[model samples]
Target chain A: GQQVMQIPQYQHVQEGEDFTTYCNSSTTLSNIQWYKQRPGGHPVFLIQLVKSGEVKKQKRLTFQFGEAKKNSSLHITATQTTDVGTYFCAGPLKSGYALNFGKGTSLLVTP
Target chain B: EAEVAQSPRYKITEKSQAVAFWCDPISGHATLYWYRQILGQGPELLVQFQDESVVDDSQLPKDRFSAERLKGVDSTLKIQPAELGDSAMYLCASSFGEDSVYGYTFGSGTRLTVV
Candidate 1:
């Protein structure tokens, strides 16, 4: 019933270039979480945003939640080869047990 | 660091065969979830369990997919008459809480290839 869509399905950049991925949901979410999955690896938790228009930063990465709670974005400044992976944004399911994940934005950084 | 445990990191089965995957969540974690990720998509929920009780399984294909957490400590997912479309990575994740506030700790996942 609910859907989350991610923009820029794929991206490739130089080692020092910046990258951004956007996620939009069909329904308003109470909270949103970000995850990263390396090639041949499982999804790893990155960050979570709850408040309206909230922004959280971890090292070189920044996560932002839209004011309406229907969208979110992740930005990386000066990406590196190690930053190559698929980034997914997940919203809490209304029933409150599982998360609805966006398709994901795959980032490839070249040297 | 504690991590979720999954068995048989990979599986290859013939179409119309049966396959199963196992998972053991971190100690003391009450919530467990099963998700499937295709080649280029994010993980999608298949089922969720809370201490041996199923909280939801609406996305699971009941006709061919079944999951159980009998003791609430470990779980198993079975697919009968697996089809080519069932090829994907099956992920098992756990959280200390029932909601996303704590986020999830995912296992390496079982990559299935149906021939």
Candidate 2:
């Protein structure tokens, strides 16, 4: 079975500090998608990385896919209070239409 | 923008009672999924449906749980004889395609608590 593992189960940082979460998969993935869920909300899609060694950015958030397609990272520059949420990385299973999600990294930004 | 829809945002029932939740996926999406998220945990896939046909349900507790996506548009998940451990958030998500590049849109989940 394929599994995605996320590092730093929890993180707390000042509003002006930067934060990063890493996701590693047991096997190479075809693609990876990132999502964010507020404290009591449904998960929302953020971004997806399909190409190996690819990088994408959305304002202060940066996402990267490793060349081997087995890991990914999300980095937030100068975190904000609105950035408080759980970040998840999901990958499709080899034989199904569903996805396997990482445990997620819960981010807490303090002002 | 289109969004997935779910009903009964919250539910509370006693143990051994039957409960159900409903979900309506975005139009034109081909894949629908049901996930369960325990408190402080990631969403775990319970079932996957490609239109009206179920693709996978290995993680679902078949002895007590069942799901259906009839007509390929709306879905329902039911639990019979629910236990306290069944308390969690049930999320429904839909994607346009099978590829991970096509991200899914999830509906506000149904939080269930079996007392």
Candidate 3:
């Protein structure tokens, strides 16, 4: 069975600070996707990285995929209060179509 | 901005009672997934469906949990004789394909509380 691990289980940052969460997998992944779950809200789709060593950006956020497709990272520049949520990285299982999600990094932004 | 629809946003039941949750995915989506999320943890895949057939359910607790998508449009997840350990959030999501890299549309999950 494949497993995904995430770093910094919990992060509390001041407003306007930077935050980063890293994800590593026990096996190579075909693709990696990021999701955000607001307090008491369902998880929402954020982005996906497919190509090896690919990097994508969304405004103040950036996502990078490792060259080997075994890891990924999400970085938020100048985070704001609205960025408070748990960020999760999910990868598809090697034997099946279902996804295996890492224990998410809960981001808390202080006012 | 289509969304997956879920019913009974919250449920509280005693142990050993049967409980069920429903999900209706966006139209034309070919794949559906059921995930369980415990407090302070990420969502874990319980099962997945491709149209009317199940693609994966290896992690599903078959002894207590069962899911069905009889027509491939809507889904139901049922817990028979539920237990306190079953208290968690059950999420439903849909994608355009089995391996959709574009991400998925998730329904507002059903929060179950077993006492």
lDDT of 2 by residue, B1-115 (tens): 8999998999999999999999999999989999999988889999999999999899999999999988999999999989999999999999987674659999999999999
lDDT of 1 at B60: 97
A34-102: candidate 1 lDDT, tens digit per residue: 999998888999988999999999999999999999999999999999999999999875856689899
> Which residues of candidate 1, in runs, are more than 4 Å off?
none
The global C-alpha lDDT for each of the candidates, from Candidate 1 onward, is 0.93, 0.92, 0.92
List runs of model 2 lying over 4 Å from the truth.
none
Q: Which stretches of model 3 miss by more than 4 angstroms?
A: none
Q: TM-score per candidate, in order?
A: 0.97, 0.97, 0.97
Model 3 per-residue lDDT tens digits across residues B2-105: 99999889999999999999999999998999999999888888999999999989889999999999999999999999999999999999999755766888
lDDT tens per residue, model 1, B1-115: 9999999899999999999999999999999999999999888999999999998999999999999999999999999999999999999999986555669999999999999
Q: C-alpha displacement of B97 in model 2, angstroms?
A: 1.6
TM-score of 1: 0.97
CA lDDT, candidate 1, residue A100: 87
Chain B alone vs. reference chain B, TM-score for every model: 0.97, 0.97, 0.97
Model 3 lDDT tens row, A1-111? 338999999999999999999999988999999999999999898998999999999999999999999999999999999999999999986745877889899999999
